[model samples]
Target: MKSTSRQLALSLAAVTLLSAAPGAQAPASSRTRTHVQTLASDKFEGRLTGSSGEKLAADYLIAELKRMGAKPLPGQADFRMPFAFTAGSKDGGTTLKTMTANGMERTHEPGTAMALSFSDSAEVSGPVVFAGYGLVVPESQNFGYDSYAGLDVKDKVVVVLRYFPEDADQKTRAILARYADLRYKAQAARQRGARGMIVITGPRSPNAGELVPMSFDTAIAGSGVVAVSVKGGAWLIEGNGRSLDEVQKELDSGNPHVAGFAVPGVTATINAKVIRQQQTGHNVVAYLPASGSVSGVSKPWVAVGAHYDHLGRGTTGGSLAGKDEVNQIHHGADDNASGTATVLAIADALARQPRKRHLLIAFWSGEELGLLGSAAFVSTPPVALDQLSAYLNFDMVGRVSDNKLTVQATGTSAMWPKLLEQANVAAGFDLVLQEDPYQPTDVGSFNTASVACLTFFTGAHQEYHKPSDTADKINYEDLDRVGTFAAAIAKRLLDGDQVPQFTKVEQKTETGGRAGLRLFTGTIPDYASDVKGLLLGGVIGGGPAEQAGLAKGDVIVEIAGQSITNIYDYTYALELLKIGQPAKVVYLRGGQKQETTLTPAARK
Candidate 1:
């Protein structure tokens, strides 16, 4: 009887697969080219922030929405919702003065001054106090010994290091990435009654100007901090206050000795100037409403989202294509245009049929700028968040390998596994379900809101974030397949009775997938891990070693007698061996002790 029930379930699922809407009969060539070419077109200007390219992309999305017979969101006549911002250069306005033992003074570039987003040009003068790194990380405990103990930066020029405390490693880099910023530090100092921020370079980097600006893509948006790059030599003034030699000597010796300017006794006369401006950018949004209501359900909304922003012409400098000016467009064909196109395609399909739930389709901006648009949408939703049943996000859905696709969902939602499994079994596609897809993408914001969400991705390729991420590089057939798969899932979500379950264990960070090995694997390795080495950012199940008695911090050092340098080595070595193979694998259990492994087998 049990076997009969299992067979019946399979048969029923198979029959349901046949009921899935067949892809509309459109000209294959036309559909293929239109989706790929339109997005990759140069008119979009690589869809950079506050640029004409992005506006062009917006116009196209609006038109596409209109063509699909989609209506404007409530409370608006048009689909566009405008927002404002300020962007510009700060220069020719700041000056610093140091009192010297003698009566000499030095002047520096006006551009080497900082300005806050909300700040108007102001001049300030104060005694300089050296704050080592100026970081207050509670996690690392690297704060200098009583560095800021009772010290007030209020109305004073606070000099701090560029990166962090004396050491440089992954933890320190991550710390700096999360906390270190001259603008925020200055603001904190200002709030504490400090006048100005003077960031001194460390011995590792004597020149302050050596700190180049990371592209806007890398930083979290809306963190109010103004930073200026200055050179060590430029901070020198023989008689004004301090000498270059004195500052360098103190920096090298790690002593807080330099108090007054060199040749102190002379009051330093300082003049500073700064300039600022506000800039405006726009986000593109489009939605298609569902056709009919469910038999019992009242309000239902299934949203599909994707961000159309790219790294924007590489770092502050131009890319290798001789487009060195930051103004050159960073055509992000695969990064998201692929996802955007898939969303558009899904909109087209749903427009042909109505479901119980209304569909909200959106093409977001500021995703690259830290999921700003999606975050804003969630906070001030066009529709109520509770009404939103599920969000299916398509990001990087255009590429596939060996006909394999990765579908990521925050496992906190119970509906995800069931829906994903049904869709995969129905479609008969080789689908890899990943529980933690919320990583640096728009879907992450929705997941954080406890909204049931799923991200369809083809995994990262070599061209990720590079200029090479052009339209010509997309795999359209695979994209079409992904789009079809997502559409099917969306249809099911609209019909299914399951409400999103907000599980308590929302994975805050990616834990790597289990490779069912005896060795430890801490970080979740990227899909491209094999080619460019594994980035310990993702894992499938608990890493092999962890399930086999390893911990989160353990690093795999050896597998099957082969040295493991990265995730690739571990995976490669795993492939060479077989299931149930008895092997000795070694790894660092934590940072202190090393441990050995035994046999490997299938996980579960």
Candidate 2:
């Protein structure tokens, strides 16, 4: 009797599988594992955007969508949508030469003296001046430390120490550390009319005498001033009868009285060359039409997307790899390949179901480079932005520990909670629903466009953004379950009689790891823009930017009397602003300069 009961259960399961839709009948785990393994394989080269590896991944995704009978979006010739971006930056060639008053001369090569990634490509010859740990603390802090006090650096090369004072007290160190960034120091030198700047790691600081590494920089333009870091520059200051060690010790005391001096008879010439590589990345977009269409009434669309790009060889930055794993391929299995696989699975399942709304499926690239692909899609969308009912994104959904799944951007629509609850009745997931839509993913792109959005994510893990995040570590069973759960949600969106309404949720301002930024302007920068000044993607509702009459497509040129050339400059200028204090903001809109007063609010 027991054997008969087991056989009966098995037969019922087989019948249930056979009765389901053709796409849904396939083994979910097998399909998900195959997709992840192939996409994260060694030959894919970690799918770095604009690289050969990314092209290969695109081809694979296109072929998979074709196999599922998905068609290109309306008005598109093919599934490939290309967008240009700065892939990375590198030193083309750098040369440094110095001549002393004693008729001694020396020339340094690129490796011995490295140009910073943000350095401008220029050749300048100027007399050298030593500026002690070049830092300009904001006046609001009242720390009263200025490295350029009473020093004239116009048309001269300013030599400054890297990092802040090593021996300062904890409170003082914290305050100084906020303004000690190398870019801020270079900005100070440029503001003082310095032609060039040289940096040296002081003897008291860690990694003394080591040249700064040329990390990857995404900015197409330079930092407006030529800058380089040297392994040693003791000879520049030795003419004053003081060794570099003695000067460093004095500066390490963090006293306010230490003054810098000119290096007598030392003239240096610097030539810096930084090459910003621009490449075109492809976003795979396909459409699954509704089962039936009514004449003269276009059906609203719903989108499901996931980014297919990741760090390559851990070289283009965003690598959390340790010393041992340096330069290794960041497989990015759980980081985003898992999300890509889930999207594919969801697409496959939805293709066979009858739908009232058109399903737009996309595989985005350049997400690791600040959601470039998704932003481009929204900026120049193939369809009307107002026609999009909702967007669902999947990222880092491979590892579902303790059956917990986090669904974010629930506040974007009032209907999300009920829809998600209905979908999870079968999934039985321990759901963690968050209301904020300002996430650091593709969902934010949709949110800014006034589209209702949802993103599914598993909790973060130790292997995130590292080479150790390989395909073998993925929880394939849970990944398949996530796909099923998301497919259910998408099904409801596609066939429901009413669409979800967009809701704007006011989020409390927080300094998202930006050092020393205490006030919130609620301005979202368009990172992909190569404009001379910071471009506004969109202003947060009810925030300072909106209240000041700033809107999307505005280019901020100056803030609080400081010039804003790029995002970095904007960040430095933002540090100078005080809470509840209104500052003059100069911006350009429609080729005309405009002025406004923005009163910054304290971060909560």
Candidate 3:
């Protein structure tokens, strides 16, 4: 006996909630709440990416699609798509030892007197070089202080201060704050030919007590140099009979007055290691054929999607719950379990009534980890991107309170607002439409590909990405309404005569979240670009990168003296750059290595 759509709906029905976007009367379903509860249950282990919990979540989605008679997305087998990514770095253990040329040596405990997360597992000893601040702002020649100016640290242990110029003007301080990354400091030292580094808080600097704590090992793989902070490093500088305080005072003045010099008779040994473990995540996909299917059409596909994975135990990526809760289970019921359940319900409704245009339903993983899953799919899509009509996305749709709900991608297509309004007529939701396409979701991946897209969000609450976001916290009735609303919109786009047209909008630069970046390179990194170096897709016109002659298709292999392996390396390298600084950059064009000097400007 074939299961009817009515039977599927009857299998789950028990709740109703208000939409955040105005008034809405939509279908009711107990399964909507049940799904959220089940997904966010403690048994799922928070559905962390690449973990057993994530695998279980993927399997559940696959089984659901199979039950709904949903076919594979074009060339896919079953409903699963897999991908791999580096989930940052982890610390195993570390060691630190110091020695003199005369054979005197002292060894100390690791992670106490000094510690590091992404340091190479190497034992290197070199003469100590007092490279105050260890900064190299070549662009600030007139008023900038370059701790590296006229200082040679090649094959030596260089000591540097934490943070930027302590006495910089408000404007300068704001700009320099973005470059205070510790890894960038290590990269800077290695670029200057230093074999190792020792970090010390300058006496005049605020918070000059102990080094910042490393609660857990970070997961970025690096082999740059052995670096550490020291409890006994003051003796090295004090032995030179010069005041470290005076050195810091002059350096913090934000003007050039002192040059870094060698610390006499002090040799050091550093042993630091960071363990890098690889992990895998998956995406589940299914396709629904058009009623009769239209041929000879430029765009013949419509899609709906949501990320099914959440932080396992709150990884470093999308957790805003603070460092103290790293090991806590992030149920993510509202963060995405609600969205995932909505996708299932919508797919079931679509399966009952097929369309004339192809429908690709995808459930992505790793959205919290920099949109890795969706990025991978869009990069190597089963079908060409141009063939896609429009993508409808549902994320965080489980918590719609009041009568208001936000709908994105309104600016993506001229027909979107009317289409959304028409669909909501039945559901009667007060729809709030946004125009920007640059968002932190799977919708962002499709938007960058010029695909017309719409993303639904119920807004964030205190429970987002936290263990508190359990199924009990989900508003099931609202999720079901959103599902029906989304399904109606998707069906209209599929069967309607007027195809939604794609519009190119200014991709806005995200701000206030990057924490420590003040300058902008204006280089749009191609997340899909698979190259040894960082690839540029579009350079903001008249921005620093464009003004420096950097163009699209240019693969940046080296910046200053630091090698660029990927976006992570490029980000760390960017932190070393200062506003108005001219740094050497090496790129590849059709296999030819070329170089340019980019004078970065203040981030507008």
Candidate 4:
């Protein structure tokens, strides 16, 4: 059944006018209130990725969509889009031991002492071998020997030094693709048949037990090798007189080769016991068909989507400077539930009105885990990609600070600016417009596919990504205005004669930029919140960030040795470090602090 185009257009125009002319505020519909309440309720557990709460939210959305008389996607007969994820352990173990050549056995710290995710217990020890940076790069420096040249690290432990070449800032693509810098070093140590890789931490430092467990980028998360940290100090070997710290001191000062310890009878043991459990989550998609479905006419489709996933229960509280607190629900009311509620209200309005195009209302999962669900949707879309005429996204639209509403990617589509201008004129609401399309939201996925994308957001608040982003903090009246504005935009898109066109930048490399580096990955950055340490909203495919394994929702706490207190700090730090220069990056994931070395690229 198709609706008549002329009638649909007329109806949409009426909605646009009604939404624009506001004499007095109307109370929010029970439907919208209920949705916001339930989705962000404690039962949802912050709508964490790969959790049962997320599934519950999905079920609720599916039920609502079914009630609206919307049909399922081509293949599936339901509204739930399923996906899988693998969340690793927060702490590898409680007990980690390290030894030196002077008969001194020391216990390694948990977060500092990294270990292989999958490794068997072993107790075989051999003489310590020092490999130069544990890196094998013949292209740039032509280091004559391979990483393990003439040196044997089979079954025996490989004592590797930290940090890449102190001068990597002067070259491009100087290291191997997969085996470059510290990641490469760890992988090389594991692949060189070494029982373990002992990484030397920067100088002797006290353990930092106050850090919080936040999400990590994909770069360090996906490395499968196990390793641990070791302090620089002297050690008594089996019948050897030289110390491990003495050997390291000589290497750092000037010596080119290991000039001291080569003992034989020393032995060590490692016992690891880890139990991993599989987790699942679902994406919630609902639709509101055109009001005049019985008539015959062609109408474009508009999708309203937002991810409802948050940091969930982690080792960190809302603030990173506080003590390590666990089992606290990170109620992402503003981070998402706000946007989720807006979608439900729009669905209700569209469901009641005689509209032109079919409206799809979707809530995504795994957004906290690198936009996996949305990426999967774009990869294998339910409807054809071309059929998706426009995408309207709402990430954190509830908090209206200083009455400022930021509409991102207004330039992504030709019709977007005009539509928003009309809305601003009619609604009497001043819309702060920023031309950044690759922002911290799911719209970038649609933008990447060459479809028109627009994101409606209220500027960041203190409660973003924290347990304090509760429903009470939501500005309901402001939300109503935002929702009405979004619906009007959708209506205009459906009724307008001209379709939004993709305005490709001259250089695809500069389209979506992060840290001033040219990155090809299409992921957006969430500048809405600075608490999660400045972070990128998304990672483009095959881009530098992706090449380095940087995933979405991973908080970038530091770049080089600079602390990234906010997005500004992050950008400044990146500016100091030139492109193609490999630098050691320290970030926190799941409460445990880890480091990864990456080479930045020009913005893509």
| Candidate models: Cα lDDT each | 0.58, 0.86, 0.75, 0.59
Instruction: Write one digit per residue (lDDT tens) for candidate 3, span 1-604.
Output: 1232244234333222332223342344766765677677676788888888898788777766776678887666667788887665544556667665566777767654455655666778888898877765435323365678888899998888878778878876655554455776777788778999888877777668356444342234443568777653565565567788777787786765567888877788777665656668888888878778478654788888999889878756567676676678888888798889988898878887857788888999988877788888887898788888899888898888896799987788888888888788899888899998777888877876778999999998888877778777777777888998888888877887777888866644632124446767778776544466787755655577777888767899899777986665687777668778799999998889999999877765
| Model 3 local distance difference test score | 0.75
Which of the predicted structures, 3 or 4, would earn the higher TM-score when compared with the native? 3
Candidate 2: 10-residue stretch with minimal lDDT: 1-10
- Model 1 poorest ten-residue lDDT run: 526-535
Mind giving the per-residue lDDT tens digits that candidate 2 earns over 316-433?
Answer: 7789999998988888899799999999999989987788888999999999988999999999999888888899999999999999999999999999999999999999999999
Ranking by TM-score: 2, 3, 1, 4
Q: What is the lDDT of residue 585 in candidate 2?
A: 97
Q: Of models 1 and 2, which has the larger TM-score?
A: 2
Query: Candidate 1: misplaced stretches above 4 Å?
Result: 1-25, 84-89, 95-122, 127-194, 199-243, 246-263, 266-277, 293-296, 316-329, 508-604
Candidate 3: worst-modelled 10 consecutive residues by lDDT? 12-21
Query: Which window of ten consecutive residues has the lowest lDDT sum in model 4?
Result: 204-213
Going through the candidates in order, what is the number of backbone clashes in each?
50, 0, 23, 34
Instruction: Indicate the TM-score of model 2.
Output: 0.86
Query: Could you tell me every candidate's TM-score relative to the true structure?
Result: 0.65, 0.86, 0.77, 0.64
Global fold similarity of model 1 (TM-score): 0.65
How close to the true structure is residue 521 of candidate 4, measured as C-alpha lDDT?
31
Best by lDDT: 2
Cα lDDT tens digits for candidate 1, 328-348: 556788878898888887877
